[model samples]
Target: MFQNLSERLEGALKVIKGKHKITEINVAEAVKDVRKALVEADVNYKIAKEITERIKEKALGQKILIAVEPYQLMIKIVEDELAQLMGGQKADLMLTGSPAVVLMAGLQGSGKTTFSAKLANQIKRQGRQVLLVACDVYRPAAIEQLKTLALQIGVDVYSEPENNNPVAIAQNAIQYAKANHKNVVIVDTAGRLAVDEEMMNEIEKIKKAINPCEILFVVDSMTGQDAVNTAKAFNERLDFTGVVLTKLDGDTRGGAALSIRAVVEKPIKFIGTSEKIDGIDVFHPDRMARRILNMGDVVGLVEKAQQAFDEKEAERLNKKLRQNQFDFNDFLSQIQQIKKMGNIKDLMSMVPGMSKMMKDVDIPEDAFKSTEAIIFSMTPKERENPQLLISGNGSGSRRKRIALGSGTSIQEVNALVKQFEEMRKVIKKINAMQNTGKKLGKIFGR
Candidate 1:
């Protein structure tokens, strides 16, 4: 996502490298390069020109600090401008009504149905009773797809297989939600291959009927400039409250995310990070700008970690680690939590400077597959007491059985056991150091 754009912008910023001050000639060179980068990234030419002009003006007018390098100062200006270009602050979905109706709108294949289920899962996690209403009656399997996703996320779905009227189905779903005490109703509307009068009129009618609290225009971010154009047309008709940029994990040039808000005057409320239902993230413009600049998003990474880690489970694991009793069971649990946090490369990219370091490294999604398979093949007792395989000098048969069960080699099993023991020893040493510190504190009475 934005990989090419990031590299281009980095090169553009380097124009001021080794410069002592921000002068007209160097700033113009930098601005020209930046404009070219935006155009190559598929950003709208007019919007790109306007943004670069603003950046140029700010760069020339501001006073440079003696301590800050020229390149650093230019980066700061561009970051702020990028954040403002993509909406200066985060925009949250408005869910105020008793059953807030959020209508999803976009062209066909924009991921409306999937994003609806993702939104339902997100709202459900907020302690709200979310009901997903499948209103795409024209599509044959759209309703079924939504139902499947809703089931995976443990959210209720409302649909009428026999009814062809989307408006009526939406109304009925609202009534059903009211009766069933569902607090949020997400209406997934039908979309056309292209914007047509009939499709626009139908969605407008549904909007009028539902009186929705929020109307989100979901767009495929990989579509580049086309996504921005589609957004303009939809906003001209539906006046959507926010935008959902789907497929951000794809090979996106990031034109839609950077240009849609400037063209349509709307905030991007959410971004689809992956194909998983749990891959949704609230759009944060500042964090995204930092990421685009290769500055990393530590706050976003911490939030993901917090969401993935359970407090009670963490406390239990901490106790076991302190007692030197951590085993494969606990290890497997931790692995599952990390897997739930989404893609491994994405997670690691959030660390400062890791993005550049991982550019050429190919970290597969199933990097933990072998480790997990080995652990799952273990018996309950064996999992609880990993020493059974790692402690003895002659545990060849046990390792061989585990290898066969997990479809791995005995050498692979041996390697895993060796790594696990190494981790255990490190944890023990850390615990011992902490214990020594505590004892010394008690004795010194400080």
Candidate 2:
């Protein structure tokens, strides 16, 4: 997402590379480049200058370690400052009261409605009964849109289609939650094209009426500095508890994420990483800073994996692998689990050093479509027994049928069968080695 900024920052750090000491001349040169990078990434000029000045001071005043290179020290300093510029740590939502109320606010087209559903889905996954309150009475079909999303996420939505008062809708929704035993009520309020008194007043009244435990101001990160300014206005009026940056997966310069907390004095609670309902992630400043500097977020990647992979299913797959029973059905299930982890490119970028390596690589979202299609075309027997599709007397006809069903060439089917056979062999070898290891451990007792 911050590819250009990351590349520029890397180039900037190279200014002091190979230098034994952090000299003022080299530090100034590096700091200048860093400032330029930040500015080019749509960060405010004054904020960029201030942060770069701190970096410069830290570089000059620090005592260099024997093992740490000058470039490495500078990277650490920049990463720390960037994290500080954003929130120093992750901010969590306060879900208090019998039914905690969360008020959503933002300008029109800021993804306020969509993020409401995403948040509800996340809270529902956390074992809470969530009620999505659609208070956008002015916009046509806004309530219906929320209803559709709520249905997709399997959450209840409260809306008064005929009622124009958002404050009343919110108040009634809270009552509904109490009566229905819902523990969380997320009120999605309306937004205008620009910040205005009417929109501000309505949201403020709703906030007062509902007394939300958290007021999240959602903004489009692609809006750059404008998102920061809009957040400032909302914070001044409604005094939001936190910020939510949406559309972060777009071709954004990342200025809003870096500047909003410094400007509005609020923590960024969550970021919308993709369009999927499960695309939301708790904003972690240190991880994001590392990512911006091209040092990938291993912790975040692991968290994604933990969320996507089901424990019971994982145990099942492990048993299959250990028994050398890994088949196409199991392989397809694994692919689906990985797809649930969000965008392929985004997931890969989380690996250490992969972001820089994939800077120019275009990994499409549907990169696995062909593989999935080919697998789906196989019969249950064929999927369970890989040998059924291999090159043989009867296997040729089976492969041809699969190729026709999957809309792929015969050569593609043959290649997939060959790859699957190789994979099965590898699994068998691994299982054999594991068995041998266990036997040796039992035999060589002290």
**lDDT of prediction 2:** 0.91
**For candidate 2, lDDT tens digit of each residue in 69-166?**
99999999999999999999999999999899998989888999999999999999999999999999988889999999999999999988888898
- For candidate 2, the clash count comes to 0
Model 1 misses residue 177 by how many Å?
A: 1.6
Off by over 4 Å in 2: 193-195
Model 1 residue 323 lDDT score: 98
Q: Lowest-lDDT window of 10 residues in candidate 1? A: 190-199
Candidate 1 per-residue C-alpha lDDT over 180-211 given as tens digits, one digit per residue, 9 for 90 to 100 = 99999999988864458887888898999989
Q: All models: lDDT?
A: 0.92, 0.91
